[model samples]
Target: MANRPKKLPKALQKLSKPRVDHIPGLVIAAPASNSGKTVVTLGILRALANGDIAIAAAKAGPDYIDPAFQHAASRRRCINLDPWAMTQDAIRDLARWHIGASAGALPDGQSDGQSDGRFVLCEGVMGLFDGAAGGGGSSADLAAMMDWPVVLVVDVRGQAASAAAIIQGFANFRPDVRIAGVILNRVGSPRHRDMIMEACARAVPDIPIIGAVMRSNDLALPERHLGLVQAGEHPELEVFLERAGAIMARDIDLDALLGLVRTQGTDHGRVAGTNGNDGTNDTDGDHGRDHLPEAGSQVQDQAVAPKDDGAAVSRYVERFAQNNANYAAPVTIAPLGQHIAVARDDAFAFCYPHLIAGWQAAGAKISLFSPLANEAPPQGCDAVYLPGGYPELHGAVLAAADCFLDGLRDAARRNLPVYGECGGYMVLGDCLVDGDGISHKMAGLLPLETSFHQRRLHLGYRLVDIRQQCPLGNVGAVLRGHEFHYASTIRADGEGWLNARTADNRDLGPCGLQKGSVFGSFFHLIC
Candidate 1:
């Protein structure tokens, strides 16, 4: 007899993947940045999750940080769905993937819409219509592609009547973007709310005001260079989310909002509003540039290389037109050596949750160790992974980590697979110079030295080609990822494989270091 279906592991199964009548999905968008979308989105997600609702959160852009916060707030696995860099099919598949497993794997038409599911709560990036390349990659673009409704969050502070005008303009701005409803954020008082409600009735009479959030200091999230301070750093995160959820439940029309999302939806719904070409400058879309690199050109920093087979990098170019994200398992960059030792701590905490989750899903055992505490990788582990983070802030502690340093050097000598990125790459190097210009000795596994003292932002999307023998599969394997760091390479020795380019299609040259079995680069893989 055929084997019966075994239950998925609890860690994966614990995620709320409800079999539903329909996926009541909605995009929490704003008229502009800082219009209170993040807080509003979080509150909505937290409230729904607390009520035993199966909800999944997503961000509609190429950001790694905001999704972390969304995941934290919703207590669910959140994914990033980008329009510019990722194909429409990839976006659609990922959208469905974000919602739990459906009884049928086909599109809504192939099977009935009665599949079990989870609702997607997407946090829009920038403004609703802001796209760097034409209007091709905006949050509106994603909404249009998926035929999903957008719930606009408007800050009604300082002006009451003008808020209605903003809503009407947006509702009538683009025919392709559907403005399902509006949420008035930061209202002054009952009178202020009443005035805005009346104005909204006059301007966009049909659009419902699903929420009227009053101005309060409690809902704000702290910010920094990347974005909001990491969701993990928040001490009273649970308390904050609970309070925020209560606020949304008390103020926002959760029942009406859920009703709007539950309406029989189709991908071919009639779009709302329209747009005109008034001639404005926009960056040209990211073309492959058709430039190929010669083999054996080593790079100093981490970068991507072209695959020997050269799969057209621009295959996933169009939105609302393609049919596959070309899903691939993240190339196993760590040793298949029985056990995996991952460095996890404040000083080294940039590992992607998906990669680790994937490892566990594949039945791999994971062991975590802290380099900050001067602890070494536990015995019996065959592979070691050191992810990137703010090592500059904890330079003295890492420098004094003799056990970790010695154990790491011993691992390298023993030829165990070792890898690093940015800060981790710094740890695997000869030395790291902190922002104070003080030097500290590192593992000295790779012939490299990096410095935070000479910091400069090196931020951009990258396409990598694994051209040589390494943990990330054999030669000719290709990967799409990004590089963001303030540290710079101050010294390097032996050659490294991999060539890459910017989103603007500029050559980034060869990058990554490979000395014996130890290797790493600063690029963080997304696919």
Candidate 2:
């Protein structure tokens, strides 16, 4: 990042500043995945979003889909706060910028804007303590780091007394992990729920039973590979949200759950969210208050609510004027491209919505074309972005896409900026092997080959030190992203240029292959 600007990137100028906030949030976790974490979390988000209790939602670990559902539930742009992929500073900065900051100042110096630091509800990824490397990047790890309480969701389907054992194990397993409350999921009957609650009280009297969700097949969301289908792809997401919210609001005790998140961290003059945890902690000098920002002000305004249906919603930062209307609004300093061509389809669907929206807000035009549908990039596009997706399943069809491949080849020969991520990274190589061990020729942009036959998961947070200038950033640019792929490299194009390190600062050595204007890796850029 030698050519990087001395000043902070305009994107983070508003945020990245150190401002003290009485930030109090909770992390919803489970013992293992498929424990109804997503449904319960969404239910809570919807139940609390009555326009009175100011709430902000975030997702722990490196996931793109859950955050979308979170956003749909809360009507806010859900931030991805991966403890593994991001530093402590970055995680806190994002939370503060999106959930803690407000547009105007208050008499008590508290926020008077959208984010008044009232309540931050975060959904955990996978199991509570599951991480890419040990438990460093897990949801429990994030809670411990942020000084937040953990609400463990146990799927008590067929067990009654054993549920208390599960609760006790999670609560007492780690001292650093503070299991403040428990939410029982998939209860067969009211009697069943009572039995579990009784068992829980007898086992761990200190741990509170916040709620018990009744089992209902109708409440389940449609799912496929890559987790629950993206919120945008679901036509009845809004209906599902309404139903989930109704169930939670009807079944759960809102006041009791709010009481559980009394004070995970120090309540330094907190005047936003009420501390009604029944005197659980020393909140002597604390008085919860709500302050709204003054009119016609601007500080943090990135989240946009979706329209009527559960259709796709895009989030991007908007420009603001300094004082008067005579001057032009402040603009972003850097952009991905003037006119960008993007490979967008079911085959390539993991692009972050915020990135594209931010680019457009910076005077960049995006032209999306589908390669799976035998379409090439739109004309006059300067840069092409191929996001990660399930390319291995469609290897044969993609290989026979002569029109798409030929066009990409021409674009690569012209030295147009081209970047691939994960599956896109695989398709840019010479050949890709499908699940059946069938070899298929790809764009041949880079001299590399990969196979999914001998699958091995390479998943974690990566800190990248750019070795050369690329469209993403300048040489020496320090970028934080994640790498989660199953493809094993058969031939790695020999010479690599990825300068990366794991979350714990272990050197990953050369990882990516960059050939001319085409550069790719099995890494997915988050920020």
Candidate 3:
């Protein structure tokens, strides 16, 4: 017997009229950083979700923070789509997975573009055209890959009519990329809004004025050195999202914006894009150098080994365009153990959702605990993962957590895999000096000392080869990830774990450290 289709609730049915059997979506972009695109993206996501519309969100590039806020706004898991670090197929697969996961499994013949009335909203990173130093991984690349129209969020604070020139230039910049609309942010007054709108209409009449957002303090989110404060730490987050949504609902053209979204044709309209060039002149046309480890070394493989077939380390080489190879194809790194304990709190909140999702997909169970709340990792867990976050801000409190510190040491003694990244890595050290120059005792599992007082920015995409066997991977296993931290290593004494180089081939030498079953680095794995 054929089963009948389940009907939506009355509220959802009322909101589902305009969706024409397609999972409509658009990329919210900006001319430059701090152009109010993040706020606009959050506002739109919350507004649509509030209207009983199913929403899925993603962020272009390797950003762990923005996706957290996007997830909070849309009430669904948000994934990072990094054109620099991830292949086009992986990006599309992630998008499809996110949509299907959010809106329940798609019907037998349905495609990503034909969802159950769910809308996918992607927030662009940095400037629309800005990418890695060598090129590729820009917001423009993601938009072109997805065949979605871009809605530019122009910050109109310092300029009025001149804003149209920027819009016109971008509209004609790339013949392959489409500019569908504009959202005027930080409009001074009615006269200022009128002037910008009139200029845009006269200059780039094809690009519609999607919205004119007035200047307001309500939409701004607090920030720390790394990025915006974690969504979990925001006390009035609900109120802030509601107010932002209300403002977007009042000012933005919700219906017109939806109209600009592209409906996919089974292949998700992927054929139109996928040239794999992210607008950079790099040799790979993807991003920085992809260094496969040196060949002819073998070691015992563990749960944390690369999930794909075992391959000897191949020497680092520049990929030319002859074969048009995608060196950044996503690699699934196996989980550390069957049951992994992850620390989660305001101080330890920089974990990536996709990494966790990948772990679960590989048949691993994740148990979360809070060090800031004086909680320890769950008992009987085989491994512990401490993610990067603002541990420097709460150094005193973390130092006071006796249970958390003791449990971490106990894990180290038990030879359980205990891994950390950046902030997490700092906590596993002997001592951490805060921004105020005060030293706090930390878990003495590793012979490392770091200081926030003498901060130095260490930020970029990293191509790393495992230097020694650790829980992360076997020796000579190559991996791709990112590193962004302000803490400086004050003192260290241990064997190097990873031999890393920046995306552009700048040698970073050996990084992080390893001792017994404990190992970590400043870099956060992306794949």
Candidate 4:
């Protein structure tokens, strides 16, 4: 028998039309990691959004910070489209979901007069062509995947006409990826912008000059041990976004600029009913031959299954029914799962909000534990999560906290799942040698020792292939994550337990180790 019919809300049914057109969008790309891309993108989005345009925002790769800024600028829920971490279908679905949510509205809710025109603004990653180690899955790759036009955000500093040459190379380097326009960022003055404009006009006349943002030291956001401070922590973030929007609106020629972008077609028809068929068969079939049930009924039937593809479809239908669900539901852990205690303090706070949200949404109760307070795992905590942070800074305090150390050791002995990131990875080691060559005691759960004295900057987004069964998942399973730390950890006895490797096939030594239930890794998983 076919799966039961999923009931959707009346409001959602009324607004069920596809929101995104075949028209390709725009991706604001850069040459490197910090090239004022976020500020420029935010300015563009805010300026356009202020004009009553229905806007959908997306992050090009596995980033949590830029999306937050995008959300604030566009006044919409920004979605992350990581080619490595998420499937192609997931990327398209995310775009369509945001487009749909932004285009339609309830009878009683806020409605901007004309709702037909929906535009998507995708913010690119580190560099335009840089991707995971093997050289695939770059921002350019994502732009090609979505058939989006590229709006390069070039930081116009230290070079004048050389910037134009760089832009020219990027434009001609990849024939398939479209470079629509350029937004000159960090331009020194009006004369600086004029020089940049003239250079670009001479070197790459085909690429239009959209906007030029002046250099402003005051606009810089503060950085923490991690990347930029989390958007939530920035109280004046909205104010900054507004000021940025005003600046762009005043300076940029929004209408003429947007007109330069060519709309490319997408194949959305391929994705319509391919969500594992949760009984949304709009096809002609024999009604008497198959016993079909209601939408919620089908969901109830699959409620007991460990991983139900149909459940995701049913959940989608339910969200459509509610008419309040915004972004597409991400693939998550099973609901009614065991509880996990996650360490979340200033010293160890690199957990992804979505991962935690996904886990909680999947029915895993996340209990927040603090190592800085020397807090023990709460009663009945089934698992422990120790994310990356500046544990090295609090080495003395952590060593002094015998209770927290003893609790971690006890948890390890009890066979509870204990996952750790860079800083957390050090915590599980026998000892940590600080920058001054002073060693401090740790939990000694793993046969490893880390040294901050001899610092080596290991930074990149990694594609991890699971080599053994552990709390995360099965062997040979690939996961998208990132690694950024200044410490070097080597096996004390030259024995190692590394799992994944870089895109170049070079082993990223012992990303994850599993001894009984004790698991630790320097890689921070995004999905």
Q: Name the regions of candidate 2 deviating beyond 4 angstroms.
A: 1-20, 46-55, 72-76, 100-119, 172-177, 219-226, 229-243, 258-342, 352-382, 394-407, 431-433, 436-441, 452-456, 462-480, 499-509
Q: What digit string (tens of lDDT, one per residue) describes model 3 on residues 1-527?
A: 12212332222121111222223456899999999999999998888777666666889988878988887887777878888877777776566555555233333322343222244588998999998866778999988876667889999998987999999999889876777678888888767877877787578755667578889988899997888988987899999999888888777756445544421222322221111111221112110111111111111221111222111100000011111121221335778898999999888888877777778877789999999999888998999999998899999999999999999999989999999998999999999999999999999888999999998998888889998887667889988888998999999897678989888778889989888999888989887
Clashes of each: 13, 7, 2, 9
Q: Could you give candidate 2's per-residue lDDT for residues 1-527 as a string of tens digits?
A: 01212232222112121112334578889999999989988987877775345566888877877887887887666766777766676566555545533422343323333333345688998899888653378898898877777888899988999999988888878887888777778888877876776676578765656567778876898875567777877899988998887776655555545644443343310111223222232111111001111112221211111121111100101111001112221221245579989898867877765466457657889899988987877889888889898789889989999888887888898899888998888889999998899999999999999999978888778878888777777788777778877789999855666688886778988788899989988878866
What tens digits encode model 4's per-residue C-alpha lDDT throughout 1-527?
Answer: 35534432222122122223343357889988789888888887777677666466778876656776777778766777777666677666555555555333654334343221254678898889988877676899988887777878898898889899989999888877877767777878777677766776678755556566667765677786557776766879878877777766555545434433322332221111111223332211111112212211211221111223233333332333235225444443332137888888867866655466567655678888888899987879888888887788788988888888898888888888787778888898889988888899999898878988988988777768777777676767777777788898656543233466675667666555567677677787766
Candidate 4 — what's its lDDT?
A: 0.65
Q: After TM-score superposition, what is the CA distance of residue 104 in candidate 1 from its true location, in Å?
A: 15
Q: Report lDDT (CA) for all predictions.
A: 0.67, 0.68, 0.72, 0.65
Cα-based TM-score, every candidate: 0.73, 0.70, 0.80, 0.70
Give the RMSD in angstroms, all C-alphas superposed, for model 3: 15.6
Ranking of all candidate structures by their lDDT, best first: 3, 2, 1, 4
Top lDDT prediction, candidate number = 3
Clashing pairs in 3: 23-113, 135-280
Candidate 3, TM-score vs. the true structure? 0.80
For model 3, the stretches where C-alpha displacement exceeds 4 angstroms are 1-24, 105-117, 262-331
Q: Using TM-score as the measure, which candidate wins?
A: 3
Off by over 4 Å in 4: 1-25, 42-58, 63-80, 93-120, 158-165, 198-207, 222-245, 253-328, 332-337, 373-380, 400-410, 461-465, 490-498, 508-511
Per-residue lDDT of model 1, residues 396-442, tens digit only: 89989999999898888899988887788889999999889999988
